[model samples]
Target: MAETSLTELLERNARHVESLDSDHFAGVEDTQAPVAVSICCSDSRVPHDGMWDVTHPGWLFTPSTIGNQVWDIHDGERVVDGSLLYPMINTRTNVTLVVGHTGCGAVSAALDAVQNGPGMVPAGIEKWVDLIVPVVEAGLNDERIDADRDVSLVDQLVEYNVDRQIEFLLESDDVPETETVYGFVYDFQGVYSDERGRAYLVNADGETDVAALRELAPTKYHDAVDRLLQ
Candidate 1:
């Protein structure tokens, strides 16, 4: 970033620190017990804390990856990302949310790699993109999503990616069964019928049934509970 932009960012941080109370982080300074572990894409467009309305620090545990895939490549094998598992195993966090978004650049890149070729990218970025390629391939071949998708192919694949990540989390033997995984697509581009930033609860504990998700979600999240692909 430019020097001016970096200065502006630090100035913003200074303002934020000054705005907070001295005891804002008193309890969590020593120990943390987050309620949910959010594995979201590292997309600036997708507001992580603001979207969830999380102002407090300890309520939610945030872990972001390039495409929000739950697993990472290591020694030619896929292993669950440490950031997503540490809180689940060590802290009181039992709920896990795999949040994807419409028109995701990561999913688009993976789709391109699957359809075309792995085109030039840095080695670090290529790793995450490589992991997402299979999910794009699966979404392309899935008969259910083909029939259920109402948005563009990329947007549909975004939701499909969320499902795949949640699947990875659920199947991992290291993950506790009590840690429920919830899949959501943050619709900031009006892909779904809800409002501008409606976080659609696409899957709950691997269950993609929209009607069943309504039962699992609270009444306030009734509007947020929906599915584009059954």
Candidate 2:
């Protein structure tokens, strides 16, 4: 198959726009209504809309970053407080979804930086990946995690990063009290068993236990908790 050109991509988007009716976004304009804010990884395989099964526009405000990591490093960092959190706070969105995925390139890069050094990658990338040092350290220090095995450490970091981001949001005063945040790891490989299409419920309302997760999570996620947490 031939690679698609810029012209083709533009024409395709134009065709999609032309096909939309005038009422496409009828009730969504000029309002700061409650919407779902999703912070996910910048991986094309994990399409936010498709994952949520949302076909309509304006239902979800998605801000994707590398490894789906959120930080409170300082005021107005473009990735954290500027673009993603600003909109979430301004819109007063009631739910914040912090999603991480398996096989994340950013997570891999972070691991490499931790094992090797910051000089292994570009300067900008080194700093960004360094933000995840705590997560990597936690994984390395944990007795249960086998750091020698690539998959074990990578998977642990992926889930840990999601939990870490959720914790950051919960600690922030900018986040509304009415907001309910959830953390999830989108494991295309299920249960650490190489199965696919599982959304593991790692954290809910600041709780990571199976009991707390069971109370708040949908029935679909119960099995994931059991399998993945096992």
Candidate 3:
């Protein structure tokens, strides 16, 4: 038989669940445990479990959506509030991660929509992209930044989107005041970028001193957590 596509593979696996070992279902009902919540893009390539393993280890609670935009209102009416915000506030997971990526189709489409016109984007998509337009505007307004640089302005916009989303998360009532939140950009190569280069962690709070983070003894990641804890 020919190789199966991922969807088909998943379907096939689901069919074989009855014959699988008992351990597959063991401890499956443990719902009280706390987890680190990660809000990432809906892109299939960006696997949250694998990314967190390389960056921050152990169990995590992850929520995903296209564009990674978390807004309280939807379609001019508050239908869903913010997706991950409520969970962060109510659940044991206090830490939240807003992960963005390079070459994001949504970000690129939004930039194009702003430059040209909404064109083919439907009303819902247009509304969603509108949440990220300010980041694109910020990237465009930065004189020292070149839109055509090696990483491209769109990539920078994606990074900025992550930062802005973090701000949105912070401003929401659903996010606990004491909780720690982080933002990062996952590049096309799966590398997270920061001012410190391919960093796995980037402090979304603009107040963090980049120079001090770079000079930390153990690692920038550790120092970032320390700063937040302080």
Candidate 4:
């Protein structure tokens, strides 16, 4: 069978969007209240809406970046203080999720950078990949991390990157100390996963425990756990 051209694919997809009722916008326009804000990677495989579907429905405001890493600046009153963190905080969303993903091209490139030097990749991509190198290095130092297996290494890197981005979000002023923050990694299959199978949670200190935290605070903790994985 012949593969459809890019133009044909896009034209078909555009028709799908145009078919939606204009009234669909009106139904959501007045209800701008977002219960949570999700920060995830630019990976097309991980859809924010689909992930959030695991939880009860409410409008979720999401901000996506290439690497899902937030950079914090001290000495400012900025809410959601990081570059990608503010939108959710400004919305005063009850929860914030920093989401990374497995098999990320950016992380892979970053690993390549460390192995082959930065010259091998483009300049702009190198900058984004640089953000993840520290996590790669950390994985390298951890005895449990398997540097030999590409899948294991990528998963570890994704988890570590989520932890780092969550820490960055926590530093933001918009993120209340009382407000819950989460870290998650979406796998290639679009299923969220932890160290176990699919989907896990990071505690306030960024430790993974699916059961313990759920037992402590059912509602808030479960929401945090689910959203992070999403």
Local distance difference test, each candidate: 0.88, 0.73, 0.63, 0.63
16-135: candidate 2 lDDT, tens digit per residue: 999889898888877645477888888877888877887778888888877787663665442355556766778777888888888878888878877877656677666668777767
lDDT of 4 by residue, 117-226 (tens): 87556766666677677767775676655667534566667776777677655665655665577666665544343333233455444545656556655674474464
Model 4 lDDT vs. the true structure?
Answer: 0.63
Clashing pairs in 1: none
Model 2 ranges with Cα > 4 A deviation: 32-34, 75-80, 148-151, 190-195, 226-230
- What TM-score would you give candidate 4 relative to the actual structure? 0.70
The number of the candidate with the highest TM-score is 1
In the range 140-208, model 3's lDDT, one tens digit per residue, is 776635666665667667766776677766766656777777766665553232433232444444333
Off by over 4 Å in 1: 1-4, 147-150
lDDT tens per residue, model 1, 43-129? 988888988999889999898998888998678888899999999999958899999998899999999998899989999999889
Clashes of 4: 2
> Whole-model lDDT, candidate 3?
0.63
Clashing pairs counted in every model: 0, 1, 0, 2
Worst 10 residues of 2 by lDDT: 221-230
**Which stretches of candidate 3 lie above 4 Å from their native place?**
1-7, 10-21, 24-30, 54-58, 74-81, 190-199, 204-208, 214-217, 220-230
Give the Å error, residue 59, model 1: 1.2
Query: In model 1, what is the error at residue 199, expressed in angstroms?
Result: 0.7
